[model samples]
Target: MLRRQARERREFLYRKSLEDKRNAIQDKKDKLKRALDENKIIPTELRKDALYLQSQLEFDDKGAEGVTTYIDDEYKWVGVDDPKIMVTTSHDPSSKLKQFAKEMKLMFPNSQRLNRGNHEMKALIAACRANDVTDFIVLHEHRGQPDGMIISHLPYGPTAYFNLSNVVMRHDIPEVGTMSEAYPHLIFHNFSSRLGGRVKTILKSLFPVPKEDSKRVVTFANQDDFVSFRHHVYKKPDRKTVELTEVGPRFELKLYEIKLGTLDQADSADTEWRLHPYMNTAKKRKFL
Candidate 1:
């Protein structure tokens, strides 16, 4: 099993490298095609190979517009199978954090909550892989307040790290009835950019496909890089009226980093993306 896994990883990396080259060529082809269509000068770098790329463009078709990347491989089975998620807290978590982890488990259908105990990260990830868990989430706390979240896609990954704030668990809300366990319809607002789209895919894969008539809804709204999470259930009282009720466990997530490997390989994984808050344009920039 170990040898097979290592060989598969190597094959995936090799394919990813080839995909990167294809994407670069596709980008150049796009630029050349645009310049020609607009009757403008071809870029200096592409002038030498303009004819070759132009000839290659003739072979392109609508079906081949976007080349598949490693991201496609990562989520190839997204809609086909329900994601199996494992939710756990940091080692020796506080009571509040434990409650938060439970709520998270309830949030994602087909998810299981596990006790952290004294298990090492490596061993925990191994167990999850053995069980065929699709995603593993670790909630962290600071002084008894949940403040961090790490979501790692299993087998192979593109782990996302987020700063959690304003967490309101179900236990904290009075009269918040039992949460719904049905697959939820997702609403993602303001995730327009490429990076935003990437983040959206990561978040969306957590939940399975919902039925058209499912009343449960989960919203991830982004404003100035902070994603506010809200859960709701709706009903139609009359022909023209709709009633909505807010479910418990609301929170905000700010992405800090995305690594291209599982949690256990954090030290060796390549950093896919990371927030730079100290940059001069940090205040003016908006990421998702």
Candidate 2:
């Protein structure tokens, strides 16, 4: 009985320590945020310490908005003219992932799932350069769910990394490919953070980049509590039969992070993007 009590006391102490550590971290972040909101400059000695917090704050403030790095500086329409996009999963040859890529290709006929030679980001970029491929999406999956994605734009770019949740496959939606769609509009909701930056990357791949600076906003929203994205198709009032066909974002993205280079710098980019590891569901939560 005494030993059990001692163990319980130790566990309580450990939990208390963890809670205190978390609270201290939160307090520091709150202080930094307040200072930023008030436009107060930190002392030089403290600036180094606040740099990380300031960076995170700045990241949140813009959330991939106004980032033009991905825009083609030379051709301006590398992927837009023909819109050749390549989709490939991680090196692990998961048949389901390959099929998912195929469905993605069917959804956008211009896109193709590379059967061979799509291992590293650098190799993918080289292949794209050779094949005139302008955009590419690399999906990192965990237990069949595409938890993360690396979106790259060609000919000088700003690649964007994204987090995906509640992913619904094309096959899951009944008669998805068989049903017809008439250019359904994209509905973005509550997309915060570098999501705007990533949105440009996605749009450039699917369509053409906007030529002029026009004040337009497409916020990402869908999740109940957090930011999300959804695709809605409404039947025209004049139509008797429901179009019987619809389309969605294919998958929702959180635009968790952004970077300046392409697959050429994938290693460092992965680190910056916090690349999700591929593993079973339980293992993923424990390690990845």
Candidate 3:
């Protein structure tokens, strides 16, 4: 009798466990269904409003065709003729700068910007400008010093200077005022001091310079300059290898730290420009 009772108790425990698992699965399915329904319903009204608003906006714009108003000054269009270069600088094949450049070109198809310029960028810029170049779209990040001694494998055309340290120091902004405040000291620590050492090591390993030490001193620049050097001067670190390290200015950091859930009407370039945080979400966040 005791054995039969024990057997019945065991059977009851097994059935209870099975029932709990079945209920849990059912609960999950119900939750998913509810979530899907909620998503579908929430977007439906928003979609209708957006479509109607967009059509109304189009009609308004069409109605004001060829009528120049005072408001037109605030909405000046960036003419499609600017010569811009889309630079992607990094050791990584899939860097954010590269992706941003690709997307930017897609969005503004008329910009005349290349990845990197050959030889002295200043010289190139001067030449391009003399030939009626109005604008340049370069990676703002590449405006600084690069990793290693040799800025790039590109050749410097005589008076061309490769090192951006010279330019950086010449900037009117103080260290405290610049983006250097946010990053660690490891970036610019040995930059000025070890410039000679780094250049020697890079040249010995990468390219065999025909000129003396003085010539080499003038040749070393930042990453983009280095890549340009390789392209125009040296022949070692191929076009694929040369890269700009930093992204855009730290202003993005300042803007990103704002905890506002909704943007104000005055906070944007246009009312038509909806805030799609997808790109921000896609970017790798260094800070929490």
RMSD of each: 1.6, 15.6, 28.0
Candidate 3, residues 69-179: lDDT per residue as tens digits? 222221123232222322333333234445444533432223333554344454454454345432333333342333211112111100111222222211222331212
**lDDT for residue 250 in candidate 1, whole number 0-100:** 93
List, residue by residue over 65-133, the lDDT tens digit for candidate 1: 556789999988899999999999988998888888888888999999999999999999989999999
Give the range where candidate 2 is weakest over 10 consecutive residues by summed lDDT: 210-219
Comparing 1 and 3 on TM-score, the stronger one: 1
TM-score of each candidate structure, all chains considered together: 0.95, 0.54, 0.20
Model 1 lDDT, residue 153, Cα? 95
Over 4 Å off, model 3: 1-94, 140-288
- Quick one: best lDDT, which candidate? 1
Clash-forming residue pairs, model 1: none
lDDT of 1: 0.91
